[model samples]
Each structure stands twice: as structure tokens, then as C-alpha cells.
Target chain A: MKDQNGFDELARQKLAERDFTFDPSHWTAMEGLLARPGRKRGAWWPWLAAGVLLVGGATIWITAREHDPAASVTNPGGGPRAIAGEVKGVNGSAAITEMENASYGNDHPGTMNADPAVPVTGETRATAGTMRGETSGEPRMRTEATRTRKEHGTGTSDRGTVTMQVNKIPVSSISVRQGEDPHAANVRTGEATNDVSSTMTGPGAAAVAGDGASDERSNLATGAVDPVRSDASAAPAGGGTHGEEQPDSVLQHQPPSAGTGPVVVAGSGDSASTGATAAPAPVDPVAAALVPPAWLAITAPYELTLLGGAFSTTGRYTGVDAESWPARTERQWTTDFGLEAVRNFGRHFAVGTGVHFSSYKERLITDEVSRTEQQLSTSYFWVAHDTMVTIVVGDTAINGATYHMTQLVPMTINELGVDTDTAYQTMVIRQRRSALNTVSYVELPLLLDAHTARGRWVFGLRGGPSVGLLTGRSGSLPDNSGEGYHTLNEVAFRELTVGWTARAYVRYRLSAGWSVGVEPTMRGQLFNSLRNADLDRRASAMGMMLSLSYRIQPTPQP
Target chain B: MINDHIIAGCVRQEPKAQYELYRALYPMMMAICTRYERDRQEAAATMNQGFLKILDNIGTRRKEVPVEPWARRIMINTVIDAHRRNKERKAMEGADIDDHAEGTSGINDYLKDMEAEAFAELLHRVPAMSRTVFNLYAIDGFSHAEIAGMLGLSEGTTKWHVSHARTVLRNAIAAEAMARTEKTVSR
Candidate 1:
């Protein structure tokens, strides 16, 4: 106790002793570690924000592109709205200029519609006719499906009103404003039946008024007459007299191409002015198929992924028990490859199936030792007449006294107690023996996956059971000490194994269709790898898997 | 000065607060470094290396524990690393233990008579391995088993080094006292 106390006290005194004054210069050297160039701590949030913004912008661009085709079909002008107003001036040619000014703008001058009442003829007129099914050869059955909407104006009284018809069929009510130009008072109402007068106001009225041009085209084909000529002839008639007499005059003046149907022309210029009419042509069939189907409106939600990585068993053989020691188990890296197809039910949940090919290896190493020994046995010899003679050691015992000879005569005893021998030998040997076990398997996995996208990254979890069949198995026993180690086969481990696998992943979207991801998976076989063993030893594998996924969308319906 | 806030500032590697922390813990850490390093310059280098490690890994420190002990642990580990690097180079040098006979002087008497700097001079007389082992095992509150693992030596070897360090220091102190008394008598 005294020695221990003395030593402790002396050690404490020695350690407590030092010159501890501070030097200001030492600070420079220590601070150099923090100031090393290019060693700045990187902040990840800014990069993450930039990536999110980039991905968001790309998504918006892609969505806009998908809707671009349908947009062009409806709005041919590329402007906000289409205006189809027409006004006839002093001459028939001046009528186009007046109509352009009234519909578009005063400054908007155009010669595209020089003859405003010339039936937008040929292909456009024929297509419009076939759209409503009202051509010469076709039946009037398309009229029953057409629903006309009525438009009411500020004035309810029928003043200079003209009842217009197209393709010899009636649609719905059309009312003109009393103070407005009756020549350019052509207003078309769609199936919505909402009053168009509220929308028809100011310079923009022509813009909003053209919104229902589709319905007007259908109505134009319903009357079985020349639509533009009827509208033009109706432009000048102001009174009931012109309204009553215009149909007869227009019917007499119209050519055979304009059909023999009754036409009504009303305007404020004179009693009844008949306009020129163009003939309708045959409808085109190719244009009918260009209409897109309802099913092609949405994007597809299936994903295909290719997975490749390495996996290893998280198992070690500790020689059966803690005390029973022999060798160590070392496992090699195994290759894993898979192809997965997932069908997404929604944004968050999906079901998937995949085929996987994988292989694993393990080696058991043991230390070798050896042993050796020696032994001796007795023999009998006889001499006769100075000549040596040999005899069998057990012959005299079986014959009793038959081989006995006195004096110099040869005698041999089979039971003779004889010689002893000993040998000294030293041996030193140490060797290492190893056993290798390899297995390859094919598995089919059915899994339910769930995922969510945040900015450019997608986080997901997928897990399910797989039916694994052992395709190949090979094993080698320790060569020198072969008795200590035994070979193994697929039957030793079950040929068919049912195992569960689960993985969590983070994927970065590379493009709209392609994404790259890394997933860490944990898998374990339910059945034991070794049979007839007291302790259950199941092989479990855990590793990080890298994958590239491609999204496959459904083709646009014809 | 060595509170949670200064620890946090050091974790962020802010120079102003790191300077404050350095000035606060300078004396004690210098004492630790000086015991392990023979030269004052080498001790400064070791202490700075230890401080750099503390700042670099300060963010990982547990919040419940005081920062001083964690910093001290880094300092001790740094000193051990220095000892290991110099072990083979200094193995040939041996202590001259026959310079003084054993004397019955108490540790208290030596402390009362000598200043800390004077005691440090006597500690230099002990060999390097013995000195480091004593500092780590006795003063640093490290167990013989832990010191063995840290220095990669057997527990018995660490115990022997501690005993040998004590014997060398005691003899050196006794020899210094004898010389002083003789000089006073001659005067």
C-alpha cells in the first residue's frame, strides 16, 4: 500500500509539472487547418432548390407541348379569339373590307375574304357539310343530333329580323339588335344556350362572338341552302316586305349548285337584294379520321427499370458453437441483376413484378495438424551344425514337441519371448485447409411499391416475397484433412426457397421518361441453408442496388 | 468561455470564437502537451494539432458532456500518436538511473520546495515512454488497460512503465535536492 501510494503521488507530481505560458504566434499555425483552400463546407440547399426549379420548369414545358396539337385545331389564328363578322358596303368587293373592319379592327386590312358572302366554298364548305352530315348524297339524319341555342338581345320586337336557314333545315332562334347594323348582325349561338348578346359588345365583341363558330358551322349545314349567299342577301332587307319577298327572289336567282331550297335574304339597302352563291363539293374522308379520340387525353403510368449491383450474405460460421473452433467463414461479393416492371395505380402506389439472377460464395478455412507413432514384435532363430536356420515363430506351439532336438540338433520354440525395439521420430507440420461453397439462384418477385416525388427526387419503398429456385450448386472439401469437412449440394439447402425482400430508394429524374436511382435492399431466406442442424442458419443478403428506369406511356388512340 | 455557445462557434469554425476558446483552454492544454513533448516547439505543434482535431470533430460531441473533457481526450490521443511515431527512433536512448541513491523524501516536501517549471525540469530526466505512460495512466485518469490498448502494449508493460517513470522522477528529484543542499553548505 505504501509503495502504491508513493508511486501515485510521484506520478501525479511529475505530470502536473510543465511551463504553460501561452504564445500568440501558435494561433496562426492552428488556424491554418480551418483556412485550407477548397475546404469550404458545401451547403446543399441551394443546389437542391435549383434542381427543383429546373425540374418544375421542364414539367411545365412538357405539359404545354402535349396540349399544343389540340390548341392549333380550335384556334387557327393564334390570337385570343376568332371574329367572323361581315359587312357589305357600296360595292360587293367593298363588303369584305367592311366586314374585316367590323369583326377584327379598323386598322386590320385584309383581302382574304374579298367576297364575304361567297360560301366559304370548296373543301372548307364540304368539310363543314360532312361534319354536320348535310351533303347532297347524304341523308338529313345529322339534323336530329344538332341542338340549337337561342340568343336574346336588348330589343325583343321583330323589326328587320331575317329567319336564316342552312342546308334546308331549321336550328334555333336568332335575334338581331335593333340599332345595330343589320347587314353585319349575323350572331351564332352554341349548344350552351347562354345569351351571346352579353358577350357581344365593344371592339372585342367580334373576338368573343367567334367563340361559338363551331356551332354556327353546324347550323350553317342544317338549312340545306347556300349559307354565305343567304347571309349576304339578308344584309340589305330592313322591312317585313323585304323579309317576305326575299326567299322567292333568292330561290329564282340561285343556280342549280345552290340547290332548289327556299332562301331568305333581308337587308336595309332595298326591297330584296340577291347575292351570288357557290356550289357545295364532295366531303373528304381523311379529314374525318383526324379527330382525336377521348381515350388519348391522359398520360400513361407504367415504369420499367433495370437493376444491377452486388450483394453478400450477412452470415458467418463460428464453428457451430463458441468453444467448438475450427475455421473462419469468408464470403465473396455476389452479382445481382434484375428487370422490374411496375404498373402505377396512382401517384403514390404501384404493383410490380421482376425476374432476378444472383449468385453467392462462401469459404471455410481450417488450421491443420498431424501425428505419428512406432511399435515392435518378437521372433525366434535356430543354429544347426554352425549354420543358422530360421523357423516360424508359431509352428512349434501348434506341433507341441515335434521340432525339439537336444544339444547341437536344431530346435525352435514358437512361443519364445524375444526382442524389443524403439524408434525416435520428430515431426512438425502446420497447414491451412479451406472448403468453398457456391450457389446460383433464379427468383421471381411480386412486390407492391409506393413512392412520392419531391422536386427532382423520388423516394420509394418496395417489398414482397419471391420464389427462389437454386439453379446451380458446387462445393469442395478441405483437401488434406478431407475427413473433417464434407461437400454440400442444393438438396442440403432446399432447392426451392421462399424469401422476402424489401428496398428503399431515392431516384433523381434525369428527364420526363428516364430516371436514375439507388436502392438499399434487405433480403432473407425463410428456410434454413443447412439441414439436420440444431441451430437454424438462414442466408440473408443486404446491399445497395443501382438502377435506371424508363417510363412507357400508352400510345395515342386512333 | 468553454460553454456550449463557444463549443457551437468552434463547430462552425468561426475564427473569432475559436480564438476565444483557444485562449481559454491554453494553459492546461499546454501543460499536457509539454509533459509529452521534450522540446517547447514540438509541444506547441502537438497542442495545435490536437486543437485542430477538436475543432474539426466538435460537431460530433455529445451535448450532455462538458466540452473540456472531450477536448482533453483529443489532446491525449494526439500525444499518443506522437509517442508512437517517435517510439522506434528513441528506443536506443536509455535512462542513467545510477546517478542518485534512493532517499526518503515525501512528495509533499518536493512540491513545497520546487516551482512547477522546476518540477518539469526533473521530469525530463525520465525516459520518453515511461513519461508518456505515466502522464496518460496516472494524471489523465486513463486505466492501465486503456493505456495498453491506446499505446498497443500489454497491461503489464504499461504498469512497468508507470513504476519505472516514478522511480526515475524520484531519484532525479532526490539528486537535485542533494546537489542544492551541498551548494548551500559550500556557500
Candidate 2:
């Protein structure tokens, strides 16, 4: 219990001493941080996640369209353009059989042969499942069907036509064979809007004969042949031009809209030619060389700033051994303003300097002793009975009288031992006195600065030595004690003193080229304010500064 | 300014009132901060941050209760935060527990006239954990269980830390007293 009580008392006594003094600049710096706009540090992540999701969705959607063949053929408001036919020998003959509306199969958009020979103009054909196969240029017997739905008779259409080249050797051109006029069906879609030709460019019959000779020979003997074997590669090359056979679903051309720019379809060799020219546009070397980097284009090199703030003077006794003292410093409200210009070398670093006009007033409380002289006076009641005195009662002086007279003598004596009836009075005297010291320094500082910036935030550290050329000095003691206020002579303070100034600050950009910031600064004199004062006694200034800055745009490179 | 008025103003977040309260309470808070952080600059920073916290959470303080303990708790929390931030550095500087203990002086009279600053300086010599335990248990009137919960330690470990801190402080204080005595005798 004794230990606990001791600890409690110790803690209380120790913790209660509030004499701790901090560097005023540090407090100002903290104030600057507190006064800054609140940070939105935690808010950026959700937006970043949303952006990732959007990009991922777009990527997946693009990939799906590139591989889905049926999706390519089935245009909006138009049914699939299927071509149904049965091809046989000279005796059996081939014919267009059926047509029907159908959705694309929910599988890899590969080629398919329709259910055996339905009427082409009628709507009775079956929707066929997609058939997967390798590329084989061979004769095989099968019935195929197609359905075509024509909606908009005038605008754009998904009227796709398949042309099977059935020459004995490598067929270079696959012409569309019309139902009635096979010769006229070879027209390109660009020449006739009604004609839709999917050009499959490859060496055809030779590949089939080498790879499927047995199958071809058997079908040839049977005197019936499916002209187009359902090879996956036999699928229309929607717009592919780079050796690889592409699925037909990816659009070779964008649908036309009244107000839209001409659509540039990627991977379409013909569209690229038609869209611009078969030849590349001429490049201008000088213009290309003149382009500036994106970041530099938005940055300015020179910046100017204006700052204004309040400052307080902080001072401590130079080397007081004991923590108790008459040594202290008090401050008056001081204001400062500055103008600075900075030259930024790049995004990360800059150098600058500024001129500041400031005033500092502080009362230095010191003990001074002085003394004066005065005439001493004393008054006391001294009673005496003279050798030949008549005793007289009641405050009467008896000089030379008989005892029947009864006289009494009483007197007051001065410090010089003079007898008097009155109480003594002291003369006016001059005396020593100690008075509180008041001092002020008006300073004009020129300081160098350096700083860096990231995104919207900037941090800077600046400092340099400056001289305090004291423009004026004034002092007076508190009134009513000895005399009213008395102004001291100029010799009491130094004419000039050297000091260093430093500050660190953070700023945030409020808009283009304009920013607001707070700076915490420390300024101190190397020597004491008084001419022959103690070496440890000097004036220190700490302040919080608010500033506005504007970046000047650099002229564009010639 | 009256303490209650300062509390009311701080709760309202009036900057002038807040600054007034800061000036009023700064010394005691600085004492705690300096004790926790030997570096004067860091101690100042810690004290500023603690004041910020007090102002930020002033609404939670009950009316008519003493403000010192509440402010002290916040300052301690700030100290703990600072400690956690520099835990690795402290550990590197040998703040961790070790089995070896220094011999105690067993002299309690030395504490009778010890200056507050001197006592604090002596307390700084104790290992961080023991010093914290001693402060909480002996001075702040926290139970071992509370110290254990606060420091994430067991009750037994907390008890050991208090004992260790007392022994270290007693020895250091006693040694200081003996040195002063010898210096006086020589003089």
C-alpha cells in the first residue's frame, strides 16, 4: 500500500508539470497537417474493381463473337440463310429442296448438312445440328437444306450464299451456282446487292483427291455426290486473310446506320482497301517528329506562389541550470507575406526561392536591479523627567519647574537624534528596480526551396540562412510600480543578427495549375537579441503558412 | 478556462477552445509522452497526436467525470500506437523479456525525495514491458488481468513484469541516492 501510494503521488507530481516546451515549428507543422483537406485514401479500390470487371466482360464478349459461326450468319431481323440441296449423278441430278427459319445451333459454329432433300421454297426443312469435320475436298452423298428470311427489302441484309467449286483439279474460283442461271450467279455482292458470296480461297480439289481418294472414288462410282463436304475448314472465311480459316460468325462488315461513320471491320482485307485505299496514306516525318510526350504536354515548367500566415516568437533561456526562472519570452501577433517563383526540372523535383516580409515582437522578462538614496526618518514616543522638572500631566513639556507643578515631557526623535514633537518624515529617495524586457525584430527573409509532387499531393522542404536587419527596437516596463512605461535606448539591442529559416509543407492541387497548401516554418537568430545578452538567449520564430500557387505554361517547343 | 467549459468547447470542436484546452493540458500530456518516448521530438509528435485524438473523440467523454484520466488513456493509446509502429526497432534495442534479472538494492528510502524528472529518467532505464506494467498496475491502479488484456499477455507475465519493473526502479533510485550521498560526504 505504501509503494502504491508513493507511485500514485510520484505519477501525479511528475505528470502535472506542464513546463515542457516544444519547437514551435513542430506544432505549426502538425497544425498544417490537421488543417489539410481530409484524404480519400480508401475510396479508389471499388472503382478500380469495377473497371477490371468492365474490361473483363468486354474481352470475353469479343472472344465469343469471333468463334461463333452461326452468330455471324444470323443477322438481326433476318433468319439464317441456309441453302438446302441434293446432288446426284447425271441420272439422279441435284436440286434445291427446302427453306425454314432457324436459330443457330448452341455448339461450335461448324458446317452442317440438312436432313435429306426437302423442297427449297417451302418451309418444311428440319433445323440441322452442327457437324464437325476436317477439311476434305471430296465427293460425298448427302442432302443439305437452307432457310432464308428476308425482312428489310431495301437497307442492309444478311443474305449469304455458298458457292461450291466442283472442278476436277484445284478450283481457283468458287462461283455461286444460281438455281436457274448458273453462269449469272458468279456476280460479286459489291456488283449486285442481292448476291452474297462467301469466297473460300484455297487449293481445293487436289487436297481432296490426295487426302480422300477412296471416298471420292466410291461416291463417283455411286453416281451421286455432295459437292461440299462438311469440313470445318470449309466454313466461310468471314473476313480472315492471314492463312488461317476463320469461323463465319464474325462480321465481315458492320451494319450501316444513317448517322454513323464508315465501319472499319478488323481482319477484313477487302474492307481495309475499300475503307481507305489499297495504298497506305503518306506519312509526314516532320509532324511525327514534332509530337511531344503526353505527360509533358500537360505540364508547365515555371510556377509562382503567394503565401500569407501568422507567426509567433518562441524563446528560452540560454543555459539556465535550474528549471525555475525569471527567464521567459512572450509574443505579440505577427503577420507575414511572401512571393516565390519556382522552376520545375521534371515531374519529381523543383527549386525555388522567395522573399518574406515579417515582424516579430516579444517581451523578454529579465531581473534587473537598481538603487537610490533617501533621508531616514523615525518617530517614537520618548518619555523623560528632567532633573529640575515640575511634573505636568497630559502631554505637556516641563522644562525647569517645581514638583507641585507636576509637568511631563514627551518627544519624538529623528534618525539624526533631534528632538521633536511631531512624527518624522523621510525624504524622497532614488532606488534600484528590476524590470521586464521587451524586444522586437522586423525581418525580411530570402530563402531557397526544393520540393516534389506525386499525383495531386506535393511535399516540400526549404531552408536558408538570413540576416535580421533590425529596423526598429522598443522596450518599456509595466506601469504603476515605480514609473509608467519608459522607452529604452537603441544600444540595448543589436543592429543586425544572423538567423536560419526552414519549413516543410504539403499541398494539394485544387484545380489546373492552382494549389493551396500549408507550410510550417522555423526561424531563429544565431545570436541573442540584446547587444551583450547571454549567449543562449536568442529569438526564434515559428509559423503556419497558407499559400496559393499558379504554374506558368511553358511555350511549346519550336 | 474552466475544465468543464473546455470540455464542452472541445466536444463542439471549436478550434480556439481546443487550442486553449491543449495549452492547459499540454504539460501533463507531454510528461507522459516524454516518458514513453525518450526522443524529445518523437515525444512532442506523440503528444500532438494524442491531443488530436482527444479532440476527435471528445463526444464519448461523460459529463462531470475528471478529464485527466480520459485524456491519459487516449495519450497511452497513442503511445501504444507509436510503440507498435516502432516495435521492431524497440525489439532490436533489447526491449524484449529475458530470464536474467539484476540484483535489487532493497532500498526504499531513496524514493522519498526523488525529483519527478529524475524518477522518470530512472523509469526509462527499466525494460519497456516492465515499465508499462509497473505504471499501469502501481500508479494507474489497473489489475494484472487488465494489463494482461491490454498488452496481450498472461496474468503471470504481467505480474512478473510489475515485479521486474519495481526491482529495476528501486535499484536505480537507490544507486542514485547513494551516489548523491557520497558526493555530499566528499564535498
Query: lDDT per residue, candidate 1, B17-52, as tens digits?
Result: 587789888887888888787788889899998888
lDDT of 2 by residue, B3-92 (tens): 665676566554445666777777778877877676778888888888888877777878766788788889888887787787666544
lDDT of 1 at B55: 76
| Chain A TM-score, structure 1 | 0.38
Off by over 4 Å in 2: A1-26, A39-558, B2-14, B59-67, B92-106
CAPRI docking class of candidate 1:
incorrect
Clashes of each: 16, 26
Clashes of 2: 26
How do the predictions measure up, each by TM-score?
0.35, 0.31
Minimal lDDT window, size 10, model 2 chain B:
B92-101
Q: Per-prediction DockQ scores?
A: 0.19, 0.11
